[model samples]
Each structure stands twice: as C-alpha cells, then as structure tokens.
Target: MMTPLGYSIMQALAGPVFPLDMANFFLWVTALYLGGIQAIALMVHSKWLKRTAETFLTLGTVFTFIFFYFYLNLRILSSHLYEAGELGYMGLIHALSMKNLVPAFIEFASPLQHIFFMFGALMFGLFQISDKIKQISLKTRLDSVYAVVAPPCPGEELRKAVGKGERRDVAILYADLWNFTPIAEKEGPTATMGLLNRYYALWDIVVRRNHGNIDQFVGDSVIAVFGLIGEKDACETAVACALDFLKEFPSLQADLADRRLPLVKHIGIGVHAGKVAIGELSAASGQPRVAVIGETVNTAARLDSLCREFKQELLISQTAYKPLSLEMQSHFQPMGEVLVRGKNQLQAVYGRK
Candidate 1:
C-alpha cells in the first residue's frame, strides 16, 4: 500500500514527467496494488494457503534474474551480427526469423532499484505469511484441545482469554464402560482392545452429534461435557446423550459380536451441571493443557462411579435434574438421597433403570 505512491513521488521529483509515461505508471501501479491485496486475502485463510503464497512469491523472487537471462538471450538471438554478414546471409536470415521468439521485458528506470524493490516485497510477503501461519497453527491446536476436553468457543475469543481463568456454567457427563476388564482377561488383550476401539467409535458419533465434548478418556471410561460447550444446555443434552448410549448399547454389542470382538454391554453414566473454571494448566514440564476444574466436574464423575453400587446404567444429580424440561423430567425416576462416599451430605440422585 505504501510503495507505489512513494515511488511515484520520488520519480516526479527526479525528472520531468511525460504524459505517456505518467499514464503507464498509474496503470501499472493500480494493477500491482490490486493483485497484492487479493494475494494477501488468499494467504490469510490457512497454513496451506500461507505456504502456497510463500512458495509462489519466493520462487518468483529467486527466479527474477533467470527471467532477465532468457530475455537477454532472446534479444541477442534476434539481433545477431549475422545481419551485418559477419557469419553469412543464411545466419542473418535465421537470426531475423528468430525475432518472433523474443519475449518483451518490463522496462525499469534502474535495474538495481527494481531488484531491491522485489527483494523487499519478497521479505514483506514472507514475514506476513509466516506470522499469519503461526497464528493459525496456534489457534487450531488450542481449538482441538477445547473441542476434545474443554468447552468449545471461538478461536479469537479463546485466544483473548488464554491462561486466564474464567468461570463457566456447564453440564459434565462421566461415562464408564463397565465389565471390560473381565472381557479383556477372559478373551485376551487383543480382543479387549478391539472392543474398546469399536465401543469408543460408537460413542464418539453420539457425543459429537449431540455437540458434547469428550473431555478425557481414561482406560475404558469416557468423560463428556455438555451445556454451553454447545448449542444446547447440559441439562437438555447431557442426560439425553447418556440415555442414547444405553439405548444403543445392545445394538453395539450385537455389532461387536458379529465382528468377534466379545459380548460386553455395560456402560454407566453420571450427569451434573454447575460452575467450572476453565483455563490452561501447566504441568511440571511446563507443558500446558486446557482444563475444566471445579466441584461440579468431580461430582459428575463420582456419580458415574456410584452407578457401580446402584446397578444402574444412567444417573443424574439434582443440579442437572432440576433444570430439565418438563418432558425430560418425566423420563427420570427419583432414587431418593444417597450417601456418596466422599461427600459430606446425602446427594439427591435420580436414575433411569
């Protein structure tokens, strides 16, 4: 944006301007600026686009002299000394015939200045492209972490809040695939892992479809979060995803059997909704990981563990239950208050047998 006008002003100061040269200069300047802006637009899209821009610009810069070399050769071939009969009449005729093969070059007042300008442009493009690519890479990595573990948010918004803790109200789902250890020990390690792979694949589809984040997977357990992490609230979708997993459990088992994975159909889920502080937490290695930390998150996982004692497949705490839509409220049955092992008070747990 700053180049053409500056050059034009300097040129005007250095010499008398002719009407024809001024017109040509203006046209070329316009074309240069327009093309530059458009290229920048394409380069901003992704790392792929940025690399493509850098490659094209660098190649053009690197080969700038090669283009001039070809032009010089073409001019020599077209205007040979053969025309003066130094070689022969035939050579002169051949050199004259080669005139059509000569390519025109864009004339510059000073070749050194032209090269300097091109070098400067190349560096400008590279610096811009490199900086943009870094931003994109960092954003994509952060987004993947949030989508997988923490709540989903816009990349720009997330960047503005990085490392800074902020409270969010969300619904957390903790699901454990039960009886897998028995199957693994009975059927051997290979079949057990195969089952887990297929089982997790099944659950991933449902969770993503429900816009729920699969926060962490430990061994055979899956932790999912619903609520503001997605379009719907935790109370609305968290319980639904749990129920869907149970509803689809038998069918998945049958599919696993067909694949010779093993017969195992045990999944326990706990749903709770409350406030959590979301941010990046660094480990001893100084490696940072995005985390959702709060009592609500712990309570949800605890409820999932409670399923082992109650012999129930799905459970929801009052935090998630009370906010349930009327139609949803009808789907769950009250299990009364239960003394959770780590809790100070009896938790009012609800279950769907």
Candidate 2:
C-alpha cells in the first residue's frame, strides 16, 4: 500500500526526475507502514495491546529516523553528482551503493539519539510516579473503610471471613439506654444526638477494654459479642464487660448533667453465651459489616429487656453465668426461671445481688 503512495509522492515532488532508487523507496514504504501500525496501536486499550503499542512506537521512530538520515545522505550525494556535471539516475545509484551507510548514519544520529533517550527516561519516570500515587490513594481509602467498620482483623483476613462466614460459640451482650425515648423527645434532635454520641462512646470504651467486638448499634441499643474472633472465655469477658458498663454509667450521667443535657438514668445490659452464626450484613449505606444472629443473640436481648422488669442494671442468663470465676459469680444471685417473651421454655436470669 505504502509503495504506490511513496512512488506518487516522489513523482509529484520531483516531477519527471524522481530521485529515489528501489532500495530508498522501499525504506520509505517500511517507515510509513510502521508509523501507521504505531498510530493504530495507540488507540487500543487492552494490556497486551498497550505493550505492543509501545514496542511499535519505538520501532516506528527508529525506522523514520533511519529513512530520514538515509534520504538526506542520498540527497546530498545526488546534489554532489549534479554539481560535478555527472547528473544521471545511474550516478545517484552508484554513489549510494558505494557509500558507507552505517558510519554516516551513526555520525548524524548520535546526538539526536541521546536527546531521545533522555526524553524517554523522563516520561517513564513520570509514569511510574503517577502509578505509585494511584496505588497509595486506593490503599488510603481501603484503610479508612477498615478503620470505620473495624472488623475483627483488617485486610485479607477479614475479607475471607466475611466471604465464608462462621459458626462459633460467642457471648452476646445487648445493652440499651433506659428511658431514651422520653429523653430524646424532651431534649430535641441536636441535644438528643449529642447525648447519644456520648452514650455510645461510653459503651465503645467499656466493650473494647474487655475484648468485645461491637456488632451494631440500633437506635438506643448496642449489640456486642465476645469470642467472635475465637476468644477462649467469651462468657466471662461478656459478663465483665456488662459490669464495666454499669460501673461507667454514673460517670456518663454525671457528664451529661454537667453539660445541662437530659440524662438517661440507667442502662440495661444482658449477657448470654451459645453458638451463633456470624456473617456479613449490609447496612443501609451499602457497606458490609460483621454481625451475629441466632437464638443466643435473641436471648441476650430478651434478658436486657428483663432489666426493666427486674429493676436491675444488668442481667445474665444461666449459660453466661456458668462461665464466671468464683469471685465473679459471687456478684450475682439467681432471679429464678421466668417465661421470657418469644421463648417456649422458662429462662433463668440472674442479676447483681
């Protein structure tokens, strides 16, 4: 295709005296073909195609430079032949055939080659820098998500766990602010939100200190679990965590009182231990989080509800109470079996005696 195009271009430029020999004309055709391939390859998006494009670009550039230098040398040789009164196509061919092409090309192309090498190096450096910046930005965003969601372990481990899910014996702790609805209504939105923030912060501290993973916060309630990451004494740790919340309640109340905000008088916490299914759940915001669900979790929430009925700050079911140390067990007395809502059998609940 390029052969005929080159022939026509040469005829148009030189009229009846076309100067390029067959070899020179073929070089021009090869350079134009490579340049065309380079242009086409640049428009593709595939990985392999991009790599091919780069290879073609370098080859095309080299070919173009070779053609340019050779053409220039041929022109100079032909002009010399014309000046010496031996102006003929045969003279031009004979001059080109005898000339030492490699040395001439090297002499003319060395300086320009160094300049091109430096430019290529600069472009490659910039590309590497840009790629690094993009990777860092992506990592930052992922770290932010991990920090906020706070899975048992960040990165690949958490992703694998969330993917497959697990069934484990865990101690579930359910805590709800006593009388929060009236407080929210009386305080209004801004004050209510501020109070909730402080309240949740207090729970967060107490829960984390006892090695508990907060599963979710639903309205005025918080659900946390121990042994989600395979802790040995999940039940004991949960009971201790609930006790800490009771101990911290007054400080939180005092803080609210100092701030002139409507204070929640008490918080009800319930602890229960059993095998539950741990899995990922999507929030309304479309972010996935780890959570637990089963009869054990429900029993814990029911025990928390029993706090209002029993007029106690903490309630622990029999399963949770059984794992406490002797000294820890001494803190609570059995409340007897009672008909808990949504359960067929009576559940034995205990509270601090």
Q: Candidates' TM-scores?
A: 0.51, 0.54
* Clash count for each candidate, listed in order shown: 1, 0
Writing each residue's lDDT as its tens digit, candidate 2 over 236-285 gives: 89999888888867766666665676878888988989888887766697
Q: Which pairs clash in the backbone of model 1?
A: 227-234
| TM value for model 1 | 0.51
For residues 1-353, what per-residue lDDT tens digits would candidate 1 score against the true structure? 45555655665685563222322344354557456745874658565665565555544444443444544554464466655556674443343232322323344323777667656666776776676555555544433332223322334434355455778888998888777777778998888777777667667767877777666667787877665443456778888888887876876666566567788767889998887887766569765555777888888888888888888888899879998898888988888787654568987999984
Give all candidate RMSDs, comma-separated.
Answer: 19.0, 20.0
Model 2, residue pairs in steric clash: none
Which structure among the candidates has the greatest TM-score? 2
In candidate 2 the C-alpha lDDT for residue 276 amounts to 89
Lowest-scoring 10 consecutive residues by lDDT in candidate 1?
A: 145-154
Candidate that would win on lDDT: 2
